[model samples]
Target: MKKFIIGLFALVGFSAQAAIINISTDQASYNVGDTITANVWIDIVELQGSNLAQPFIGGFVMSLMADATSLSYNDGSIMFGDKLGAGALSALLPVGFGVYSIQSAAFTPSVFTLQAGLTSFELFSLEFTALSSVSDALFGLTASVSEFGSFVGTPVSTASTEFSVEATSVPAPSTGVLALLACFGMMVSRVKARR
Candidate 1:
């Protein structure tokens, strides 16, 4: 039967090229000496047999670390690891500043498959501006692969993304003196209704 119709068209072309890889960060709501600006993206979604290859080799790279307690991995003056490229995604900058180092090594992963199922997707966005008196700050994302050879069919795994840092509020001073006494009572009731 023609080899079962060419094995059903090669199993529907390897399920239309398998895919799944992600990283995210673009102001999910932060306020505390804010300075969060991140943007990183790399998507392939799915690909295997259909062959949609174009520099597709276990990939991911981007960095910006911060910590002020509870980072986990070790801390030391946090702020070091800024290398983005795996065909480059997108990066803004400014990440949790001052008093942020519990454990951070944001964006640092670039795996290019020498062989194996192949998969790569990373996305990080940005926009953070808060710094009044400080409240909290901690951001992270770590994937590794700049050098470590060994693979013939499937080896490319490195991905991480963490976030925390908030403080950008204003509404005190008696609420701006009650909004200037309700705009001076609506301008004295429109100057007595224009007489």
Candidate 2:
């Protein structure tokens, strides 16, 4: 009985320390001039032996790196997750070429807290426009979370994904355009037949 209790405590402690940061894009490929959206998610194991261990999140900062030449950061496109709640403060700053810093925090301690359970929640999202064609372009994301009460910061490992951008192709004529051209051609044919 003693050994079983010790083992159970160990398992709960291990699960409590487990957290993951995930980054994902809307699509695996894009065309030049297409908008690309990347989402950041955080999954925390909050159930510690049937009790919720939800932490009060003070703030978080995320760094994103992309190919500047092939992708243009869409200014003012950083959106905070709903879980952060309204009245949250946020900012987007350009760290360097093709690099950006996204920061967000709750107004007060009671504003933002991690939800209980194993559910994965979105932290934020960013948008970029494909400027030029590139093969196997990579977008890298890393982040850190700050606990409000403890003031302890935990760094999340970097997550990255690769995608391709193809050159934009010329669009074919639309059906409306085709119908207009056909009507003009018929009018011209009638005029010539009358002559």
Candidate 3:
């Protein structure tokens, strides 16, 4: 029972540090028409004495809001491939025009589990298209991660993150192509005039 008691205390100590889920785009800035990728990550502040040989992440659910004017929701944007939940069950719901929720859980009697240690792994990634230069300039998103707690059955903490999209100037299409098209138009106009 000594090991069990130590493990319990270790869990409590880890939980007290406050687990925070941080959300960020792969790039600090993007250009119009670029594919934007947002990554969700969890960070543990300290690891003292969680005498756990293996730790279970259990499951996670997240919700976020986006700017519909500059963004459109696309299916298959969020993905979790046996990272947190092996053979996990997951669902993505469009709560509103600019809102969404994602919930995932492991198989019952076969739930996903991670070895106990410092926690820093990607939960999932969100894909988006920079519809306008405006949205790219201010791509804003919010998310909250939860499910685990500080007990034998429940073993995790929760936190939230707010992030914004940064965008670079929108570039025009190929300049060479545009120049060729202009030359072609001039040649046709000259031939017509000569006729």
Note the Cα lDDT for every prediction shown: 0.41, 0.79, 0.59
TM-score, prediction 2: 0.71
Please state the error at residue 17 of candidate 2 in Å. 12
Tell me the lDDT of candidate 2. Answer: 0.79
Candidate 1: where is the Cα deviation over 4 Å? Answer: 1-26, 37-39, 46-118, 123-167, 170-195
Model 2: per-residue lDDT, tens digit, 1-195? Answer: 999999999999876644367788999999999999988877654312254565556668888899999999888888888666676688889999999988887765444444434366788888999999999988998888876654556786678888999998999999999999999999999999999
> What is the Cα-based lDDT of residue 77 in candidate 3?
74
Clashes of 2: 0
TM-score quality measure for candidate 3:
0.58
Clashing pairs in 2: none
Cα RMSD of predicted structure 1:
14.8
- Per candidate, the number of residue pairs that clash is 40, 0, 5
Compute the lDDT for candidate 1. Answer: 0.41
By TM-score, rank the candidates, best first: 2, 3, 1
Question: Model 1, poorest ten-residue lDDT window?
Answer: 99-108
* Residues 1-195 of candidate 1: C-alpha lDDT, one tens digit per residue: 999999999999966632233345555555555455544333343323355653443323434454534222222212322233333333233445422111112222343332224343333343334433334444444433222232232322333455655444576678888999999999999999998
lDDT for model 3, please: 0.59
